[model samples]
Target: MKKILLFLLAISSPILSISQNSTTSQIDETFKAYTGWFVDAIFYEIPFSDTFQIPWVLIVLIGGAVFFTIYFKLINFTGFLTAIQVVRGKYEDIEKHGVDNLYGEDAIVEDILKANQEDELNVAGDQTPGGDNIETIRDESADGEVSHFQALTAALSATVGLGNIAGVAVALSIGGPGATFWMIVAGLLGMASKFAECTLGVKYRDVGADGTVYGGPMYYLTKGLKEKGAGGLGKVLAVLFAIFVVGGSFGGGNMFQANQAAAQFTKLFELTGENSGLYFGIVMAALVAVVIIGGIKRIASVTEKVVPFMAGIYVLAALVILFANFSLIDDAFGLIFEGAFSGLGIAGGLIGVMIQGIRRGAFSNEAGVGSAAIAHSAVRTKYPASEGIVALLEPFVDTVVICTMTALVIIITNFNGQFMEYGVEIKEGVELTAVAFDSVIPHFSIVLTIAVILFAFSTMISWSYYGMQGWKFLFGKGKITDLVYKVLFLLFVIVGASISLGAVIDFSDAMIFAMVVPNIIGVVMLSPIVKKELTKYMNAIKKKEIAIEEGAGDLNDQL
Candidate 1:
């Protein structure tokens, strides 16, 4: 294993070295060429169906959230508090109530372990009929596998990357401050979608013989639909989600992440020249190779630490910007509100702003995309519903909180110059954000550089986990299987940097939307189950219910 990894690194080193030495002009040219192709694809290559009012993915994502909101009686809103408690282990007994009966009242230590070993196949394993278990991950995760805080952070790492800093900048530029208002609105409503999908993720997750837990929209769509006597529908949706998830894992999740990171590295370090992205891509591929080679444990470990620190630093910087422009905050909010509803002539009018807000915001948090469920499914819990409650926090934090802070910085920075006037086309990313920050603090570009890099790194690690899971979903689980995916994932990191990936990214973004088509259907169809789980978990938490000696067997860590 070490030799193979070493050989791959040896071959990639020169590619990284050469690309890093490329000139800035070359990078820009490459980027433009790629962007041009993407534009063409959207206008000419894509099927006529996509020319509709809004992309179909955005519709299912937002539409599904709305449906679940009504059907589940807004559990995301009502159960928010309980979710906190559940994650805190407040409902341990209620959760333990449903464990298998193999371990009776007098079951000994050996008996308990033996019983759990039998139940292990459901804990996420190499025997999931398809998915492989790489790295021999023990289902009984070590103490630091991923705490509730770590889990949240791990998931957060994936959601709060370039999307918040770079993506928000673009949205505000194209859609106007009014778009910010709708972004928040989208974030709020997305909470419900996060809850419904995550709940089902836990309910239908497949635990493996190795004790590792594997669960996601794929598991729930197939399992939940089948339980509802819609086996055909479930199977189709599950397959569709798995296929799209794989594409998403590769394109939006992996390559895009690498592409952004390579760009950040080049800009921040002042590495100038052509094929610079390729060189950085090589470096990124190498680093990612190391982490991803370890699979989920390594990915979770790094993200748990990186996510919170990066977020804290970014948020603190934004707070400073907000404090500097305290008076203009109201005006900014006003602009967001008025622009969202009234159309500032900047966003293609009201309809355009709404679509931009929903599309960007949903992409940012990934509420209905079902990716979060993949991460949450690993949380240690007996009840499939417990983690769902905890999962609701993701969107609120990602879009509502993180994205909001970013918007404020950009909005307040434009207090005098007019945010809507600045067009979306920017030569350098660090500059767009630096321009925003330097409004208050001079030479703040350095700080923005650091923030972007950290944000990119955290995001890269988390997405690695998401992609690995998707890889396992299709390929069988095992160490060799995982290594193959990680290596390929790393190679893409290099590819993303070296070449213009407009076509690849567009296809991936489309694939991400396509995920919503099937995943939302699954969540919507079984929203009732989500409601039931919500009620059950809440009732148990409220009553502080548990058996003194009744809660049997250890719950799989996080699943």
Candidate 2:
């Protein structure tokens, strides 16, 4: 703790002592040469035509979402209602039974006999459990830290941020109204990817002796692949994923969030001069440090409250705007379809619009990115697929609902020619969103500003946990190592706040999108594993229900 404080003081001293201009300029230069080449390489785009170029990374993301959607037989659609039920704890007993009772006395006796047989075989130097049938026994007495609902919210807190507000605006500005249609389509498709990755997250997780859960793509890629006799490939992919995840934590999850929050806060206050962002960053960093130091359990507790409240406020505001312009809603839908299919004279034609929409939609919900899998892995459930089912709601809420709302408001606001022409460059994305809200509600800019900060805060804390998992994977998990990573993360928050968006946004975006490469590769390799887990869970539920019904029928017969 003392070293942590000293590190903070040392990094912050420059900000306090130097002029704001000097600080900003100095900080910007610090990461420029170091990160530029890496960012450019990862985000390199392949042009199909002059105006319809797509990033290779995005193709991986979109393709993964599409593959999972098809391979999973549109689980996103079929499981939508089931996902809500899971989050509502409707099937919690399924998890409890597996953990607590292990299917009651029959299962216990069977397990004991199996163990005795295995022991005898081992005594003869034969063997014990082998193949895919050997299950990792979980300690029902020591369950996970957070509930399914809490895990959902914790992951949601990270995703439902400026991406919904600012990213949607950017997509619209580039792709026109048509992008909205494709964006929704991509988000819906993304639900399958989320389900696949998260189910694997819980299936391949490691619970420490102290009951702490260690999971994410790192665990799944390594352990799941090793089981398939590809240990070397799995280790390589796991390391690559850890590297990208950590970079993403600093770039997209940390800096991008801080940068946007500072931009909104300073703009709202009409603060001028260099010191505005620097000071705001310091305060934001301090606040982030306080929460992250407590780790995921504490983070989950906070997000369960903040995610719902912030989402409700933002969604409620969007609802009001939509209701007010109820008559124009049909017209808005027309523009979205026409713009998507016809392109409405937009550059790159329909293809350009589709690319922009899909890109932004994927970016917004991050269904294929595999970050949410990390959060969902911590849920206290014996059935891994239950959390995966719950995860289907994330892209729906983040992209289909919240992002579409933002797009509608923007589209509606532009109907009067109050905003720039479609496909025109948007200078400030969030500010553009704020303008749409302000057109309806007086002084709503303040509300939007508050929402931005809260979004940034929640996202930072969640990302911190994600990055810490990666960090622990690379460096051995220890107290000093954790503290060091946390301190550096908080410092980067300040750096994010102080720097201009150009390099920071580019690097962060690249780092985040780069995560798709290794993550999807691993998920695709292990899709069969996730499918097996889902089948097992469904069968267990059926048997339990049948047994219950038979017991109830017997009771009625007796009565």
- TM-scores of all predicted structures: 0.80, 0.88
Q: How accurate is candidate 1 locally (lDDT)?
A: 0.70
The lDDT for every candidate, in the order shown, is 0.70, 0.83
After aligning candidate 1 to the native by TM-score, how far in Å is the CA of 152 from where it should be?
2.0
Per-residue lDDT for 457-540 in model 1, tens only? 666667777766766776667788677767666776677667655555666776666677788878888988987887776654
Please give the lDDT score for candidate 2: 0.83
Candidate 1 local Cα displacement, residue 480, angstroms? 2.9
lDDT (0-100) at residue 478 of candidate 2? 84
Q: What is the C-alpha RMSD of each candidate to the true structure, in Å?
A: 7.3, 7.8
Q: Write down the TM-score for model 2.
A: 0.88
Alpha-carbon deviation at 327 in model 1, angstroms:
1.8
Error of 1 at 32 (Å): 15
Residue 557 local lDDT, model 1 = 41
